[model samples]
Target chain A: MKKRITEPVKKPAVWIGFGVLFTLVTPWYFPAGSWSPLFWGIPYWALIIIAVSLALSIFITWVVLCQWDTGADETEDER
Target chain B: MNMELAFGGWSGILVLGLYGGLMLAVGLFAFLRHRGVRESLDEYYLGGRGLGAMVLFFTFFATQYSGNTVVGYPPTAYRLGYQYLVSVPFFIMIIMVYLFFAPRLYSLGRRFSLLTPVDWIDLRFRSKRVSVLAAILMLYGLGNYLLEQFVAIGQGVSGLTGGTIPYQVGVIFFIVIMVAYSWLGGMRSVAYTDTIQGLALLFGVFTLLIGSLIYLGGLPSAAATMAANAPQKLGAPTGTALTTWFCLLVLVGIGAAIYPHAFQRIFSARSERTLKRSFIRMAYMPFLTAGVVFMVGIIGISAFPDLTTAQSEQLVGMLANALANQNAFFYWAMVLLFGGVIAAIVSTADSVLLTFSSIISHDLYGRYVAPDASEYRKILVGKLVGVAAVVVLVLIAWYPPGTLYQIFVLKFEVLIQTAPALILGLYWRRLNTQAVFVGMLAGTILAAAFTFAGYRPLGVFSGLWGLSLNLLLCVGGSLLFGASPAQRERAEEIIAFPPSAAAARAV
Candidate 1:
């Protein structure tokens, strides 16, 4: 039986999209209230930022694992 | 927030001694094992470019995060409040920037057997002036970086010892051990020790967090305290603060991504698979390292309110002291935390020192001063000069000119100037060599000028101002004196390697 091979497509947009959403867009929306609804001891807006930052990291790991291929000419060595 | 009350007595000395002894042992072991390869720069500088996934991951981790993540970052978090949450994302942005150039650079490294970042500049442009300028820029940045680590080591040691040991003694003790190890094993010892140090840092940081939360009441209590006092810190950033946040994201992201040591790690991966796996792991590190430390900082704001700016810098020590007073277990944990912070700083300093030596030995001396010199001689020259540099840096660290934050920005501003030549040079075939040199020179001057002038134009960082000028010159100059037909064709051919080939080079 023959195996199938698929090329990994570079999806920089995935990283860029997340980068923009988290860094550019999210900062604008942080709650203006200094004392606000708290989520698990964090202010609501701060919690949201942390949550999105978490997502960004996860997304980056996924992209790194799936999107990059350094080509076939290079060979692994134990030196 | 009394730093001098953080640690004292025999326990601190015992821990510091154990950590130092362990580092020395690792260095000696690496030296004995890899002595055969000592004559060659490749073995000394890059550990023969054969690092596996775990070692590569941890070494990169230890080098990038550094002591600052533990000691310096918390204060920023305490001062800026939620505004400092930008630290977490900015680290993530570094990995993104890596995605832009590292893949190709890795492939090129294997094809040409590139040993240093400046080696890549030499390969691409084949211009002596361009390579030397980039080398000087990297060396300056590494010097500043090493100085920061030296200063941190002194502060961490003295603070942990409750001023039992003088700051000068603390700095000298670690510098001696660090330089000894680096001189012995080069990259091998550095990477091996980095694995141990990185784990120590992780364990210590998490333990500190648990101890903090357990003793100082959990996040909810801290949040309530913060809400009652220092409300501005909790409020969202507005106007200039927001702009500065964006600028930090870009400047730190690009500046850190292109660090000479970081670039060399790309060249040192055992395989493309190893490189990719390592990066995947690094992506999550911000949360575990920077993100966790940021929370620790936020907790300090409520736990010890009303600290002046200088006192705020002692947030870690203050918290550790309070925790140590609670129980035996907390005391031991705080000891480990301080020990780990010192180890982390040493690990970072060793990496920088290795890169610093390599640039002087290979790029400046071997390439220019004495091209006919043997490999062993070049290695010797690099080592001697490295020791000398450490001596000078120690003096500066002993009598630091400015605050830690100022020294921190000094390195990044100059280092980021090299980004255009390196990052754009990877893909843009027509990037003129002369243009790269001019841009780097102009950018570096403007950056230094703006910084000294204390001109941060409209709340923007001085580095960004210089970078803007640098980018303009690079793009404009490239057009003005366009690449010759031969240069264009050569660049196209060099860059046209299939991505898979680049990946497979290490397979």
Candidate 2:
């Protein structure tokens, strides 16, 4: 039984992306009393960071979906 | 508080009775359609792999976001104010965590005919000990999670009825409806009920928001009230609260993604495309569910003002009472909102019960105890376990118990213990199976120890603290005492670039 990952296991890229987005999302990075960059009344910081988080989520989903093999023969019967 | 009814009297009871009857009819219908043909475990548990994107999405949505978000979170927001805005993103982060395992797990689930997440653990580790332990953790966590929903059910029933129904009666009525559908219909029944509940929840939330704004004023006014009375509530995150926010994001994100019920949904997805689309849409739901609850709590700051912790849990009750006093429209909307909250909890409990039964029947009894058990016997065991689990959870709920958040976090901590095995198996070939076993065990121990001791590191969740140490052992121990060449070759074979025999067999 060969160990298999249907998609390339790209760890570093995913982790770094998560790290950056996480840093941006938290309020600690901002100085006290300063309004974050504005997106519909939210701080600019929150909107920007959530955008990054949003992007990361999409990328991870894409990466996961890519692993699907529509052509792979059924393994249940073979086993 | 034998308060007068604005729209209630029987409008509320009629609406609720209709909703409950409809849920049962759907479950009974699905059971009749699928019961005879469900000769295989896959047909029953995964709906024969035919669930469309919409059904799959709503089912997954119902499982992940529950009554807690609707009935519980506002109180936290009411108490803590803007500081709890973190709840919104934390919900989003759960989807992000799913990205880590969704692609690979879904593919493997389809390949191996996997029934539960523990089956995946069995495939990855090939260790009975690891698989059994994971199942136990799942069962324990799920039992606790189900109990929390029961508590919410009681609260929601009483709140909605204005105490027209007692708390115990409320819990029993809904639990009976839930068990009937779930026992008879499996995942299909659960998903259909979820669809109804999800729609009701969406309608109720928007209505509450509109009604609240019309009567209580908008967020800015509420913010002003917080700014005046409890300045810290409106202040920026700092000290322990900020650190806890980040910890919550990671803890909940990973913990939620790996939930047995959510993982089962990965198997239930009709296709990779369906799963992908569901999540893409899900990225915005925090805005609707969590975001609305956050708004509700924010309004509470001004509306009720200075509620004690126990009193704070009654935010929804307080708001509904106030709304009912206002006028007829507000009264009706409040009743619907309370009904939706109870429905949401029932839907979540059904999912948890389904997964719990699957773990017992498929993972433990079928795989280890009786590998050749017939599909009928397996389904029977699963259903029986589901009923038994509900019985125990109801008893636990009956006793005065822990805070909603505490029970919720405890579920995550237990589930996260399995991460090293599932996530690492995808990428780390040299993650020695014994090392994976030891790491997961140690991680769970540390998490439980810290949790029981009232030790929350830096005010972060105790589970992440355990996970930190767990990941270290898995990676560090693997490097220090490397696997034999044969084992390394086996590892490479198990985690290679393309689907292989070992990977296909994964749970």
Candidate 3:
């Protein structure tokens, strides 16, 4: 008989890393002058930030779908 | 203060009445269906752990967004300019924070049949002092949060009705409806009504945005106006403003994720898949909701320039009022928007009130005050006490102090103190109970002291200062006191679950 082995997912780092990159690190890389260029009324820099935020959202969906497992036939234990 | 309605008079009154009646019908339906199963705390507080993806998703939406997103966020954006773009990303950070602990916490909830966050604390630490202190902290945070909703209800009604309805009347009217529904069906009524209210708010907001663009001109025009009038508002943020933005992202992300109401929603999920699906949907909500509202606020900078801070608080209502006077279609939409604002506030209040009573019933009364009490007796006491709490909060709302932002800070400052213990305890086995207690106490005292003293060191929020100390103590005290080998083993067992389960299989 062969035994089946499953490895735990390590995608939480992707979420944390992307979250930091979009919110904290990326904003500093843009120069103050870069905000002057407008795309459809939104500043270019602001549009970039919104795009990063959208990516973060999509990343979260992927992590939740691929990474979490609730456990099997769990009986309720009284605390 | 003088009140002005967006589409005041009979239309606002009619819409409010219809919305109220619909909520009542939903509550009655839930009550009748749940009558047989209402004896247990799980059924009443957690909806028998049977919420599907849609109901769970909407309830989480309503609780997290609230009336603040509609009424309060605009003024901050008006003041901060493009800097307020931080709001959208900060909301996304909240879902990410949940990823750190929600999976393990959900599994723990199933394993121990947990009812409240305090229950998990009591189970993990096995310390009466720790549990009682945590419950008190949660109660204080929740009470303040509920108080904010009451104030928002009164403001939204008076502002939207053009003074046709007095602030006091507005507060009383919605409070009665919210408490009635929650009392009748508990979590079931709250979650179902949340779905309705959430849809109304989403529709109302998008319509308002479209109307604003069409009437006041589009974003390109608005940006042009700002460039000519207030170029600073469109420029990139640097210096202290940029630093504050970073603090907000971290603080609000962690603080909101560990909110007691939000924590309970994790347990309310029917299955691990349901919980995950709901969260996955929730991740994208910031773009639709907060992102849109942020654009509206920025557009206001061009639409109504030179307004003072106090006047800017009325940005949404003023814009709605202008649009209502444009055409019949916008007239009805503005009415719906204002009514939805009030409903959003009520929906948030009901969720907070439900979680508040659950804490009192399950953690305080059932666990400490009357250990042998039946579920019925405990729930009865919780309901009565909850009503009494509403009465006290209503009185405070009648005489609101400071601005909405100040009251907002007060709640988050206190609530975030729980994060170090709640989030860290999930992964770290050697966290000493005494360390947690000391850290919480020091954090609470420091947060309150800093806030009262009007101290903002380097423009960073007072909550972050308290959290810094809290995390320091939790980490330092645990190292100094240390857990026993047996305690470490017990923690390992509590946090572990079979990877084959639907929730852990992915992890």
Candidate 4:
């Protein structure tokens, strides 16, 4: 059985998605010092950044599970 | 920050002693379980490459979130306010950066039985100059890093015991214990202790947050306090602060993911599946550790308003004190929290020391000085040298080097210079070895000079500035001159090995 080999570096979509998420995680796109309309006692912008960070984590999980396959472990099993 | 907990005294000393004893016991356990730990570099340094998912995850956790994360990050959050929320995502960014290289790095590590990051460098470049230069740079950075942990451990110990155990005594006590365990079982001891330290750190931070919320106030109250007086703390970062936020994310993301100790843990995993699972678990840990501590700092704002910058350094200690005074349970818990803080520092120091010795045993002495020496001899030399380094670093930490302190601060800057060679060499076949040597040298020189001069153009860090130049030279020189055909084919044979071979192995 030929393992479905994948590397995260080879996937353009993965990079593009990460690029977007990384941008969102930085809070540079938010209005400077404009943290009004707080929710759950968190500044609105802080909340947004936290949510994006969560999304980044979830995206990382997806990439690790789906996009990382090198058959190294299957080879180890063979050994 | 010089800090002392209110509940620090005999109980603190007692807990510290117990934690040290527990670590030694763990080391003994690892030694008894694996009698051949000292017989091979692979068994000693990489735990024979058989670490399960949970141990790998905890070791990674221990690397990222250390005693500093518990005792250091809260004060930072207290000062920076919502702007410091960047700490949460910055840690997550580490995992994000890992995704770009670790998948392939893990496979290569397994294929080649790579023991240290320098091993990978030597394997790829096959140039003594490049490999030795990388090795020296790693050793220097790791030495400074261990020095830092030693200082933290001393301060943590003294502060927790309220000077019952003097700073020098506390540092020496832990150093002896740390070296003993690390000598006994090698990476196995370090990883097992890290699991324990990681748990203790988590427990410490969560209890502090819970105690603060229960006794002091919540985010809503803290927000109101910020609104009334320090609205800037409640606002999103702008201008220079925004630049700092962005710089931290990038520097920490790449620098930390490639930390020599953290990078080496990749080769220790039992299998690629275990490594992947550990990383997936690590991706979300910042929320539980960094995120919780960050909240505790914000809550401190409401509890102790109008604290000066110097006074704010004692914020966590003060908060723990207030909680301890309220109830007996919190009093004991606070003592354990301080003890945990000290243990966490030792854990981080142990990992750095382990990696430091491995580079000595595997890369420097074993490979060059005595290629025919027994594994036992190599391990012995590495241990003795590592202990000598500790003694020197302890002296430096105690009687401070009065000048040229910026040279010691070259830890991250110097380590990151190796990133281009380590990460790029994995993929780019045409990467010139001469260019790698020149780039790493120039990058370290530029970073150290800029840092010594306190020069960060455009609010960007000196390390990133050095990295930018290093990347330019690495890429430009490769595209212009490229590697020799033989080197290119070697790279291909190592990295681009055929999938058909892998498929055959799977069968």
Candidate 5:
């Protein structure tokens, strides 16, 4: 079987995905000083931001696991 | 953060003293196991480059989330409301930033046996001036960082012990304990204690959050308080708040990932897989640590309403005190929480001090001051200088110069300026050394001036401003005058990634 060696930095899809996730995390797109529709005490916009933050984490997990093998530790893996 | 509520002085003192003893024991244990820790720089500083996934994760944890996350961040959350929610994503952003450079850097570290971040700079540029400037910036930044930890340790100790242990005494006691253990086993000791400290901090914050929820109502009550009194806290950020939020994400994301100590940690990973695993753990930590603390702070709003900003800074202590009063179980837990706070501070200080000494031992003293010195002698010199630095910083903590305090506070702001040289050097082969040096120096000066003058153009942080100019000059200058052919070849040899299949087989 062949090794699937790659790096996150070499992947354009990873970059594009991160760019989108980072933009959503900042919560600027929401209306200013308008936080009605509070859910369990968290405002509506805040919930989206939380979900976005989680997405960033999950995206990071995917990048780390699936897209970041550089074959730098091939010997260790063999061991 | 200044908290007046003391959780029964004797328990605080007892727990802290026992905690210090346990740390000393851990150091002794590491020393016994790794007998060569003092004789070799790698064994001493990077734990033989054998840190497992868990130790590396906790050590990284200790670096980014210091005691301040517990003692300081909650107060900011209480004052600012959900706007401080940015803290969570910003920390996640740090891991995101790391994905850009860490993969290649880790490979390079393995190839070169890079001992410190400065060693990487030296290998990449081979310029004394550039490497030395980077070292001084890192040392100055780490020194300031250590000093801030010392200050926080004092405040945390005094707050926990209810003034029984004066701030001066508290600082001195922890410094002694920290220096003692660090001398015993070096990086092994720091990483081991960081595991313990990280666990304690996690337990403490979870308890605080649960206690706040049960004892002082939940976020809904806090949201109501904000809606009735200050709706802006609950509302999504806009205007200056929005800009501040964006600046925080960018500054903290890049700055923290390249913290000299944090950068050096990449060299300490046992393997690529270990490092990747540790980062995965870290990518989610902000939710557990910062997210929980933010909730505790929000709960503080309804529990103690209308506190002046000054008093709101005491939110954690006030909350801890209320919890302790409710039951015995809570009383002990709150005490442990304060102990965790102090432990977190010490863990951070230990790592900074270790990296500070490595720069002196491996980069400056070993390289320049005494070229023929043995590794043992170099290590000894680094330890003594580190101790000397601790004394100076502790004195500064005690007798803080009134107007000069801003210089000490420039730790992160100035340190962030080194990001371009450190990170860009990893990938961009044509990055000119002269451009790096000039950009770093210019950026630091601009950042210091803006920070001291309280000048933030368009609600952006001074550090981010400095970073922008730094990047501009670094990228623009490199474009105008790229590396020479020979320099290009060397950079290609160093950073061309994976080193080709044949080279790896030969190694």
Candidate 6:
């Protein structure tokens, strides 16, 4: 089987998703109300950001893996 | 500085010593194994350009996310509030910038055996002066960058350890290990240790988050405290702050993507596919590392509000103190966190040192100074220079004239100047060698001027202002002079390789 080399696409949805991820990681959406939920003093928004950030990592890993497979297959076919 | 309280007493020392020893062992092992065949420059400098995905990813990760991500970023978030969340995406956007150039660069690197950015310049422009100047600029930027990491190591170690080791001792200890390893394994040692260090850093951060959340009352309580006390930190960037965020997005996006060490990794990839895949994944790391630190800083705003810059800089230190007082589990977590901080710093330094030496070995001494020099001689020169660089950098760190952040940006300003020659030479057929040379020089000067002048163009970084001017000159000058028929043909040939290859690969 010939290997494939995947060319990068300028996908609008991917770009938009990136923009959303950027915005989400920022602290812009924290509401004005504060209910004290003390888990030894760490904050809810902080934890939420960390969780979201971790999810972002997993998502990135998925995306990169897809790019790798496609690109590798394409490149090998060229050879 | 809480010298007595900082080290976590015996545990901290043991951890630091163990980590340092491991790094040294990696370095020495690489040196001894590869030293016999030092004649092979590719093997010595780039690990024969055969890194797998995991090593490449972790090495790249360490290059971008460092101890600075841990110790410095939180205080930035604490001070700027939620507005500084710009740091996260700015990092992500750097990978986005990579998408524009890295694939093509990788293809070209393989074609010409390009080891440094200067090699690319040599191929593209075929101008001796242009290649030489780019090499010098890279060396300067990389040297200062490595120095910045050294300084951070000192500050991060003492700060995280609550001053147990003091700045000088901490900086020396890690830098020595970094130099030893880089001299031995070159890129291989750096990448291997980066994997270990990156893991330690991740573990440290997650533990801190878990502990901080349990101790602090979670984000809701922290947000309540922030909103009640100082809402501005959590508020959106407005006026100067908003402009600054936009500025940060552009400056860091371009500047960091163009960092010399980063470009080296682009060359180090096993294949174009590996490079592209790594970058795609890199885009999301900000959330994991920077976002985590930013959160810790935000919580600190409430937990220990009203601390000075120096005090806030020691936010992790103060938290560790408080955490230790809480329980044994918290104490161990704090210890791990400090170790992570040091590990991150060392990882960054080792990578920087590796690239710094490669530039000297491959570009300066190897290319112009002595094209016929054996790989052993080249590696030896690079290593000696690297060790000397560390020594001088340690002294400067002991007396860092300005704020660490200022010195940090100064390094980027110089590094970012190469963007025109690097990114533009890829797509622009009419890019003149003279234009590239002038544009890079002009861009660098303007960046420095803007930085030194403290001229924030509408709250954006001076470097961005310089880059804008640089790009204008490059594009405009290229049009005026135009590409020679030969230049145009060469560019067409290079650019045409990919799509055709992709088509061929697809078929």
Best by lDDT: 5
| Candidate scoring better on TM-score of 5 and 6 | 5
TM-score of 5: 0.98
Give the poorly placed runs of model 5, Cα more than 4 Å off: A75-79, B501-507
Alpha-carbon TM-score of each model against the true structure: 0.93, 0.89, 0.94, 0.98, 0.98, 0.87
Model 4 ranges off by over 4 Å:
B497-507
What residue pairs are clashing in model 4?
A: none
lDDT of 3 by residue, B1-507 (tens): 233874787788888889989999998999999894469899999999989999999999987898789777877887777888889988888888888788878877887889999999988888888889899989999999998888888877877777778889988898888888887888999999999999999998899889888877777877888788777677777777777878888888898898999999999998877888899989999888887888788878778888998899888888888899999999999899888888888898999999999999999999999989999888988888999999988877776556653544478899899888787788788998889999998998898888978998989888899999988999999999888888877776675445234245334
The sequence of per-residue lDDT tens digits that candidate 5 reaches over residues B1-507 is 555556659899999999999999999999999998999999999999999999999999999999999988888988999999999999999999999999988988988899998999999999999889999999999999999999999988888999898888999899999999999999999999999999999999999999989989999999999999998899888899999899989989988999999999999999999999999999999999999988988899899998998888788898899999999999999999999999999999999999999999999999889979999999999999999998899889889898868989898888898888888998898999899999999999999999999999988889888888988999999999999998887888888766784356446
Q: What's the CA error at residue B232 for candidate 4, in Å?
A: 1.5
The full ranking of all candidates by DockQ, starting with the best, is: 5, 4, 1, 3, 2, 6
lDDT of 2 by residue, A1-79 (tens): 6424344345566667667777777778765444433333344454554565566556645544554333233343354
Q: State model 1's lDDT.
A: 0.83
Complex DockQ, candidate 6: 0.21
Which DockQ values do the candidates obtain, in the order shown? 0.50, 0.28, 0.47, 0.83, 0.86, 0.21
**Model 6 C-alpha lDDT per residue in residues B123-142, reported as the tens digit of each score:** 78878878888888888888
How far in Å is the alpha carbon of B221 misplaced in model 4?
1.3
* lDDT computed for candidate 5: 0.91
What is the DockQ of the complex in model 2? Answer: 0.28
- Tens-digit lDDT string for candidate 4 (B1-507): 467765788999899989999999999999999999999999999999999999999999888888888878888888889999999999999998898889889999988889999999999999999999999999999999998999999988888888888899999999999999999999999999999988888888889999998999999999998989988998888888999999999999999999999999999999989999999999999999999999999999989988998898888888888998998999988988887788788888999999999999889998899989999999999998999999999999998878987666789899999999999998888999999999999999999989999998999999999999898888898999999999987787777743455345446
On a 0 to 100 scale, what is the lDDT of residue B299 in model 2? 80
The model with the greater DockQ, 3 or 4, is: 4
Clashing pairs in 5: none
How many angstroms is the interface RMSD of candidate 4? 1.0
